[model samples]
Target: MVSPKTRRVLVIMPAWNEGATVGTTVTEVMNLNEGYDVLVVDDGSKDATAKVAAAAGATVLRLPFNMGVGGAMRTGFKYADRKGYDAVIQVDADGQHDPRDIATVLGGLETADIAIGARFADKGDYKVSGPRQWAMVFLAAVISRLARTKLTDVTSGFRAGNKRAIAQYLDHYPAEYLGDTIDSLVVAIKSGCRVTQIPVAMRPRQGGTPSHNPAKSAIYLLRSVFALLFAVTRSRSKIAVQEGTL
Candidate 1:
């Protein structure tokens, strides 16, 4: 376990067109008094998301083009690695994820290399679609079965990783349909990392529609399932290669 004196945390907010909510998110996180250095990776937002984040006291990293969430996250992870922070926490710019929950993730990080916020662990915090919720549960079960490790929530974006996990991810960003939530978890498991889940509070977005439209949500589910199958079929040699390099 790392002592508070020894731990240096960097909070990375990968945001795009979240100008309405980023300022409040930043304020809440700053009020947490967690001694975190915050970075808001502006994912090519046409709005004043960058300006809002900056005004709210977060360092901003702007991407030239609008890369997806995966790209924005990778950029923040790379910066976290370069800056030599002991750990990095990835939080949403939208007001759904709570900043006060950062401590729980950090506490979990003591025993696990990666600690993810599992919404299903505690009921009633979120009101997701029945089908989508069931899909996540089924996917988590399959991932647990394949990886031989129990994971309650496989796709929740609120997560924190120790320096080791950060280094591996920075060394190689997963590219095969990496934007989807489940595939990223699969890649982390394939790279031989310890993952643990903790219950965290979440709310519906304070503004704007969900990034996943109906058609895209369906496609995401199908592709995520296929990703699990692909990860399962890889040879031991391939897994070893991935482990050694990634």
Candidate 2:
């Protein structure tokens, strides 16, 4: 077991024009006193996200252009892998994910390669409805079967990864929309990484707004379903070759 004292944990937040909440989120994570080093990948933000994150005690890595969360998170995984961090916990820059539950998420690393902070575990008031909710349930069911474990929230970005998972993500994490969530986990699971989850109560974004339009949500779900299918059929050898890891 990797003890907390011996573990070097890196909290990575991928920010794209999230200047308002990034600073607050960074500060909150730093104040956790968990000795976690915070790294905010500024994914081509046109605002003061980089400046704010750095000022709030996070190591800021600037991307040349907006690469979305997938690109930003891959950069984070690469950085953590190269720097020898024992685990990488992904947090949102918008502050929906609570930093207090971070330790609980990390605790899953004791027995699993990847630990996710799940929202639908009845631990929190977070809820979903309609087609988006159905899609989430279906996706979780499929992914849970693949991982041979019950996962309530496969789409949750609030998650942690140990060394093996980090290496896998560095090689195959994609930049496509929602690819970071569904596709990345599939790759890690197919590559022999154990996955687990802990229930966490998601909070409202500290700043900015979330899109709750039904039409957009349905479209997003459709794309996610396709991403899942593609990820499932992708063989390890084919994935390696596609990512130039072969």
Candidate 3:
């Protein structure tokens, strides 16, 4: 158990035009405990996302322009590292992930370097579309086969990681969609860091239209799939090298 004097958790929210929902998300996360520091990475939100987040008692990090989700998250990691947080939790600004699940991840951290909240852990609460379901399955299968581990939801954004994981990630993180998950998966596996997944309920967006670019969904899927495949392959090669088998 972490001592009260050294226990510090940072909740990082990568928000883009989520002024309507950012406040609620920040408040819920902050209400969990007093030691949790909330940081909202506003990616050039056209609305008042940063202001609302600050008003809700969250430390707001404003990106001058839209840098996409991954970029915003990387910025959050930087702040987490700079402030010397013991652990950092990645959360969505869409209000889909529950802040209450933070305890699950924190508890799991005792046995793992990183703990991610998986919506598919129970299978009953998952309500995504069929296409997305298939996509996630395909990705999971590929990850399991390559990473040599069973991971139900490797792409989940709701995750908690220690200071070492955060520092390593900020040093060599990717900057695109699904980049956070990919980085965490590959880095944790290659570095021999234990990663655990816990069941968490996710709800549909309570406010604001999704920022997903409909025109790029197909392209993004194809690109991200290939990117993950490449990362998996590269990570495997590194493992082989470390084992001196290559």
Taken over the whole model, the C-alpha lDDT of each candidate is 0.79, 0.89, 0.77
Give the per-residue lDDT of model 2 (tens digit) for 54-163. Answer: 99999999999999899999899989988999999999999999999999999999889899999999798998887788889999999999999999899999999988
Model 2: per-residue Cα lDDT at residue 74:
89
What ranges in model 1 sit over 4 Å off?
Answer: 175-180, 233-246
Query: Could you tell me how far off, in angstroms, the CA of residue 113 lies in candidate 2 after the best superposition?
Result: 0.1
In terms of lDDT, the poorest run of 10 residues in model 1 is 234-243
Q: Which stretches of model 3 miss by more than 4 angstroms?
A: 1-6, 213-221, 235-246
Arranged by lDDT, best first? 2, 1, 3
User: TM-scores of the models, in the given order?
Assistant: 0.89, 0.94, 0.87
Q: Model 2 reaches what TM-score against the true structure?
A: 0.94
Weakest lDDT window of 10 consecutive positions for candidate 3:
237-246
Residue 32 lDDT (model 2): 84
Model 3 scores a C-alpha lDDT of 0.77
TM-score of 3: 0.87
